[model samples]
Target: MSERVTPGHSGGLITLGTADALWAGLTNGSAVPTVSAACTCFPADVRAGYVLLGGRVVATVKAGGGQWGVPEMEVRRAAAELNVVKMDHGDLVRIGPFGGAPKQKQNDTAPLRWRQRIARELQELGDVERAAPSEGRLHHLAGIDWRVLVEETRDRTVRAWWLPRAVVRLLDAAEHAETRWLQAARTRQNSTAAAEPPSQRRQIRAAGGRQTTSPHSPTTAPRPYNGELKELLYSALSRKHGISRKVAEWMCAVCRTTPATVLDHCHEHGYVRAPVCQSCNTQERPDHLYSNDIRVASHYTRLFDTHNVDWLRHWHRCPGCRTRTTLPLPHLAAWTAYIACRSLRPTHRAPRGRKPCGVLRVSWTGSQNAPRSCLLTVTVDFCPSGEHRVLAQIPYREAAERFGTWLAETAPAVAAAAGPDRLDGLPTQPRPVIPDTNSDGQALF
Candidate 1:
């Protein structure tokens, strides 16, 4: 019969012979006790006693010298003394004082889950932000001011379960903040870059220490003259006016001397060949006596008025004679008026057809009432006799248009009449005349 014992049993200690027998039974697996099947049972007091005595348990089947084994009886005694039932081979044991499994912990698990979830959230947020346009004021916020949230929450510690959300928020904030900072830096850089001065900024000093505002300096541009007044005068006459330097020097020499006194003191008594003496002779001569004058018809001399009378000065020489002559005011006025009337006439002829002939002759015809009235005969040059004459005593202004019409009708014949006289003095050899043509190949007047 088995006797049940409590925790403080004095007979709990196993005898040495019984301990040896129990050790053999325990080592041979023949000491399967009848305690709770789920509990791990062993001869606790017997094992403790064997340990105190420095005895080692061994398998009975194995050969070993320090091999003390436990038997069934010793195991039962130990289990009963300790107030614990024996257990099967596969029973569980309690590690700590409370005799139950300590609470399982996963310290790293929560943080790992947080990191993964935050990473996924941050990735999604980045995709959304990246898809937005980078323009306008909102873009400015997205680029610059968003990073503050990230730095603030980066190292925040929270409950392990909340780690995922925390990390996501922190990363998003950090990304936004970083983008904002970079954008702000770029904006500042752009503002600085956009600032530029006007085209005409300031005067800069040249390599030679000269202050210049012009695009090109004197050294690179044309140099100005730097000389005395006399030298400047000489250079102006020679270089600017294309006069020979020797001629300028000779003029200066003559101006420097007193005319008569210098001439008398010189070896040549009166050197008329000298420009100074020649100039004096020219100045003394009367211009009218030195030049010849030609008489032009009074009718052809009625073209001028007071305002344009000065133009006659340019035609001082006669076309017949190369002699220079001046026209009286009346003659100038008359010639100008006559030319004006002639210019108003349009007598151009087409190239493909034969043109008509026309002529204006001022002959003294008989008329008692108007003695000054001349017979103005308009005749075709082809029929020079008065048979083809269109007689009319018209005023000068009215005659211009009539003459133009008549000339237009009879241009060919009229041109032929004047051709012989026009070519009489000219050389018989061919002279080149440049004809003007319009874009359409028509001759331009």
Candidate 2:
């Protein structure tokens, strides 16, 4: 008969293959001694307060009641016993880019053992560096040079990873480790649920009936801004235009409903964009390559375009109307009609009928803090084909009067269409029909 295993008993000899089988059995919720047993015979670092199931190290239970997996030394020992070679820089590069996890097929390019090794090493390094352990930190530790791009207008520089292959290797390893941790947590949670009394289990089932959350469900709430992450966000906020913790509590700039709790920035360019919610922040993916597509183009292109444009400025709710009354088609149409009527030239009418100059484009320049007034810029594009020329600059009150008067005259129809408290239109001013070749335009708000 085979030797019976007991807690804290190392007298029973187990082969490497048997140890592997025991580890697999423990992972699959088998009746293993991993929970009760202790590695009293082994060294402190290798033992790490964790009970070795067979001869294999499991996880380290910290004094503070947290688990971070087996120690690095223990992992090295396992690797040596298994005859697994250490992954070098070339091997990491050969792993290639990680384009996110696949839905159907497995995307674990890195081995589980290697991932455990890297994660433990990263955790140890993070303890010394006084920063939270993250997959991105691997690049910094590897002495990999980041590509730095200068932003003259912001008086800042943005840095991004120079190599894609290295990024993939780090991400793959991180993904594998995170996946393993999540699986372990889930298994433990299920076991706890199973141990509960029938009445309690039924109550739990009834209470959780409405809850449709899964491990893959999108996070609804924003991540807590505490510890090292909070400090990092605060440092990044220094370069942003008008973002603060108070401002972040307001409505999201992207989704417009959820509270803006996350400080969003361009990952490729590294410049702060806007205050958005956690969901919006994750959803908005900027193109790493500055492509031609206007909708999903790179943030660098959008920022550069904003600087190059003449009339465009940062858009916000109008104090008078409590809505974005600058760039909607209906507002623009009403404004154009009103401007044409005002600038009508009855004597200079052509055979094809009068085309009163061109359309008048009204956009917000910026708000005056002291006097509490908005600067509305009116640019007129002359008939047929001409550039948008500066027409006039008026206060928020004047612009409100022009747009409101026109709406009141066309009452009921236009008024109802431009719904009350409407927050419509793109976040920026309307793009000029004629592109300004000259790049000497003033900086956007």
Candidate 3:
């Protein structure tokens, strides 16, 4: 089982066994984003070195007696810097949305199943109450009041939730105990290298018989972070936005390897998220959100609205589902409108006693590079044995107006044909159909 980093299991230095396992896994088929010339070698000395990714050092590692270990603090620091999810088992690292299983279906029953599982786990730790779902309410040890929500997409649905700090601690403790139990049950491996004398253990250079010392020796290791300077920076940055002289003392929050120089903030809200290097600050500018891809737009909007806040503190909770989202008021209003428009699609139904046909689906498409040329395409014909038909092609900007007019006219009949609404008002836009037209707007046939 993989140990996830949470508020609970986030303490304690990583064990040698875990680090060794990680190193072996990474060096094999696993694709690490970064590497160094010295990476081919192992265990140069007891002093801590680094695990580099994308040419940047993300985490610090140490070796002793042919064993390796990572400091837990460094893991947390690196995770925040890289914007990638760290896995304690199975996979070494994940860069996308959170999930243990690949392409797992998240349906209506998923939340209930997870709730039961969590409740059972909690019962083992102590008393845990199961109460009615409440949006964004993180109850104390007296009860668990958080709600679990599913965000639907073309490929899958994602579940998001918030947990009380106390519950997280309890769960971490249980996981820790399980880890200890597993360690005790396993037999220890003998390490003859650990008993070897310093002189005998020396590694010889391929160029000559003389042994060469590693360039990344303890003397060359990065200096320790200044806690006092960090506190002062945090306090000062929270009050007003400006470049700090102390930035040289801190690593970039986006890339852990570089020294921070610029204080990055949300352009819309002007709230500081982190101190980042000049390159990251430039590349992640707020203007990138203007792309035609809703995914890209939504991602950047949320990034600016929530990234800094979430990283420095906790997630901003959604008003409806209470899923941890700190989306601003304007974006939230836009989201509500988008959801409403999406829910306008009527349910699909087949003739009585006849085989069922597919439902309506709507989507947007175009070259991401050319946002202005994006189109809103729709498909209507989904008969069992019949070929699909292209219903309409509306410009992206006119999608909502066109959809509203069309729905008002066709909704009653479509509703009557489809029977009652059963999908709980999820957006029902028809999936885009491949058009028969060519670049010149003429039919191919």
Candidate whose TM-score is highest: 3
Cα lDDT for residue 382, model 2? 48
Candidate 1 C-alpha lDDT tens digits along 38-119 = 0111211221111111111111111146433333343444333323213232211111111122333433112112223333
- Candidate ranking (TM-score, best to worst): 3, 2, 1
Instruction: Look at candidate 2 and give me any clashing residue pairs.
Output: none
Residues 98-161 of candidate 3 have per-residue lDDT tens digits of 3332343433212112333443334333422344423533222101112221111222543222
Work out the TM-score per prediction: 0.14, 0.23, 0.25
Poorly placed runs, candidate 3 (over 4 Å): 1-26, 29-262, 275-288, 291-330, 337-445
Model 3: lDDT equals: 0.32
RMSD of each: 55.7, 20.0, 21.2
Tens digits of per-residue lDDT for model 2 on 1-445? Answer: 2222334544333432333333333333321112111222211121112222222333443323332233434333432332321222221121101223122322222222232333343334432234342442322211111111101121144211112222333333223333333344455446656898645542111121211112221212223232222212234566667555444434455445445555543221223345554334433232221111111222222222322121111111221122433332223322433342345322225689755555444445333221145555555544455444655665655655565554445343434434346343322333322211222111111
Off by over 4 Å in 2: 1-373, 376-392, 398-445
| CA error at residue 96 for candidate 3, angstroms | 17
